[model samples]
Target: MDLFQPSPSAHPGPELPELLPLGPDGIVVRFGRVVSPQLSAAVLAFEQAVQENLPDGVTEVAPSLSSVLVRFDPARGRRDQVLTALRKLLGGVDWLAETLPPASRIWHVPVCFGADQAPDLKTFCQLAGLSSEQAIAQITQTPLRVLAIGFAPGQPYLGYLPPAWDIPRRAALTPQVPAGALVAALRQLVLFNHASPTGWFQIGETAFRPFQRDRTVPFALKSGDSVQFHAIGSAEYSALKNRSDGLGGARYEAGA
Candidate 1:
């Protein structure tokens, strides 16, 4: 059985997407309470639509796990007007049935697992009832879609892992995991953008720096991108770490 499913009933209201006010400068168009692939598709679709037919004075449109945050200049755009425009757009389409937009890029990130880089791998494998080899195979076998980029700069929340990988967060935090740490919990993977403590288990480590201010395009990954984490040897990982390009031995193809 699947461990998680969409729970539209979690909120008591109309089944349609909800538009909630986000301060004077922004509004949130929430699709549903749960974070599912379908809802993500809807959110992205709406995000694309808003970008295509941008409202007057609207400055930014960002998609979260289940919502699209539309920000505007309060001086140029009134809250009521933006809300009305958003409501009309929301009502015009069956967003939930909309197909996911094509990914902008697909990344193949090389990672070194079950060594010093992945300090929590043994425990994570134990929780999933899989041996280290088995765990690695399952994780590397499939490319996870980038659900939403948040919680940190350029950090990508990738999911949904198979049923056996639907593990929960650890009861306590792991003091700190380095930037490029591949952590997992709640059937999702979060590629850390910087060294930070987390409740998620550190399953692997990649040299890919998702956020690098020095580069022309600082954020390496974006929402709707796909990531394939291929296993690499410790030596190869070390080599990638020393390179100056900052991609960490990862390459991408356009229009994934």
Candidate 2:
């Protein structure tokens, strides 16, 4: 299908309403005013299709929360041409859930939340008017999906935290959290792969290194994978850590 044709620039429209250029090499296609999973899924479907087909003059097609950035050479096709291609793809896209790629990953990440392990767990409980156990229970009860991985390499933002779990990031940042730290905010839980400072409520720590440079698959997680963080204590994390290599993975089947 010619993803280069123009249509109405609205939801499900063939023509994108706005096209912003990234210098002379790239263009950002704005699908809507805000980031919605529906829009993200659409963007991803298009991205995957483009990756599989690969258009001429285009080098990269990346999908963010609600927009797609297309990189191409102006010498081969003007910015307009790129937009034409995008419009055609957007128009041709079929957003049925079936068209979306399977997540292909379900990871049971073990975590140690609260106290020294999670400095802000108590605070999150206080803000939510719940006790620590209730908070942990709430977190463990819900399964989260990898929303998008960015703002840092291999760093992922997972979401739709229950309303009771909603809270804003702190005004001040905490010291860098280690790789595998589980944090929550904005209805999202982020699993850190690299040590980076963050303000999201630190709820737990896991040995599951999300990013590993030596491995062929550097990032252990990807957007679309399902995750459930099981709570444990420092000693448990220690036992898991000590025998991690023996287990052969940062994570394994929960019961296994």
Candidate 3:
């Protein structure tokens, strides 16, 4: 099946969304209570629609796991007018049939797994009932989609791993995982963009810096993009670390 195509055996149709006020200047269009590929696709489609045909006062449109948050100018775009326009737009479309925006890109990221870099590898193997090599193989084989970018700057939540890889977060937080740490939890993978404490299991480390403060385009990834992880040796990791391009050793191809 196409990645963006909703599974008919699973999801019947595009979910109905609720447009609720987010204070006076913002409105949130929530698709559902849970996260799924179908819901994420809907959220992306809705966000694209809003951005392409923004109402008079709409200033910003942001997509999350299952919703789109739209910010508008209250003075120029009254709440009722903005809501009405949004509703009209929503009423005219079939979200499941909409295509992802053209701006999406696919990324191939190199990771060094199961060493000093991946402190939680043993723990992850224990929980997943897999050996160290098996765990690494499983992760490297799957191509995960970027569900959303939040929780930190340019930090992407990527996934929909197979059933066997649906691992939960650690009960306790790790003091700190450095930027580019490839962590996993709740069936999703997160590429840390900043050094921060996390409850997710750190399975690998990469040189890719998704958020570069000095770059013209600060965020290297976006929602709806696909991420394929490949294992790298310590020597290659060190070589990539020395480069100054700031993308680690990763490369990109433009498409859905």
Candidate 4:
């Protein structure tokens, strides 16, 4: 895990708990600072290791960008043991590009870039200091790895955007972005699979819903999946939304 260390003041301290009982049934073990790729990798890798070696009593283990939530089944063991086990394992694990958990799936997502449906599209190009085409070229230039899904159900913060593309969140959030809105901010791009408010640059649209209500594996994308966006226009997005003959036309299916 030494390779995951932040330089100088960037270090996020220890992976120790800052508070106990992150909840009544679970605990959150924190690691490093917020939003750093190094720390995020550590968090995910640690979660994977714990899941593989969990003692008999753990009911659930949920991992986020910088924390892991452990839920214990009282029927099996006590929370104390769970915490101790997590600590013992995480303390000894390695988290670096060389040790990443390989992806379970690779999905191709279709997205329509810079159209009226994406109201914030123009604004995003302006903020990035690039022409509309240039912005589209950059965004679709490579596949982004899924980091973690949070904030909204099935909403993923995908990233490792080029350093020059990083930007902070807007001062205010979007009033409400549509379910398929593609939002980008800082070094991450999130697929807004459901209607919600956000401040990330609304740059694209997708036909694949990342969040669904009545199905198994509702999220179309999972952590570690790779995604590339292909551009289309407003007309297609509208057709897809209308459930008309042209549904899915606006988005390109590049394959998973």
Considering every candidate listed, which one attains the maximal lDDT? 1
Q: Tell me the tens digit of each residue's lDDT in model 1 across 1-256.
A: 1212213544333355777777768788889998877887898888888988899889999888899999999889887778767766766478898888877788899999947998999998898998999888878987788888888889888877877888888888889999889998777889998999999999899999988899889988877787888999999999999977789999999874
Off by over 4 Å in 3: 1-15, 92-103
Instruction: List RMSD in Å for every model shown.
Output: 6.2, 4.8, 6.5, 6.1
lDDT of candidate model 2 versus the reference: 0.68
Cα deviation at 147, candidate 4, in Å, is 1.5
TM-score of 3: 0.85
Candidate 3's residue-wise lDDT over 100-174, tens digit each? 555467789999984878989898889888898887887888777887889888989887676666787777889
Query: Which residue runs of candidate 4 sit more than 4 Å off their true CA positions?
Result: 1-20, 94-99, 233-239, 242-256
Model 2 over residues 5-86: C-alpha lDDT tens digits? Answer: 3444443623443567788788876666665456656656666666666656898776666666779976787777667666
Query: How does each model score on TM-score?
Result: 0.88, 0.76, 0.85, 0.79
Q: Rate the local accuracy (lDDT) of all candidates.
A: 0.83, 0.68, 0.81, 0.67
Q: Rank the candidates by TM-score, best first.
A: 1, 3, 4, 2
Q: Which pairs clash (backbone N, Cα, C closer than 3 Å) in model 2?
A: 3-85, 3-88, 3-89, 4-84, 4-85, 7-15
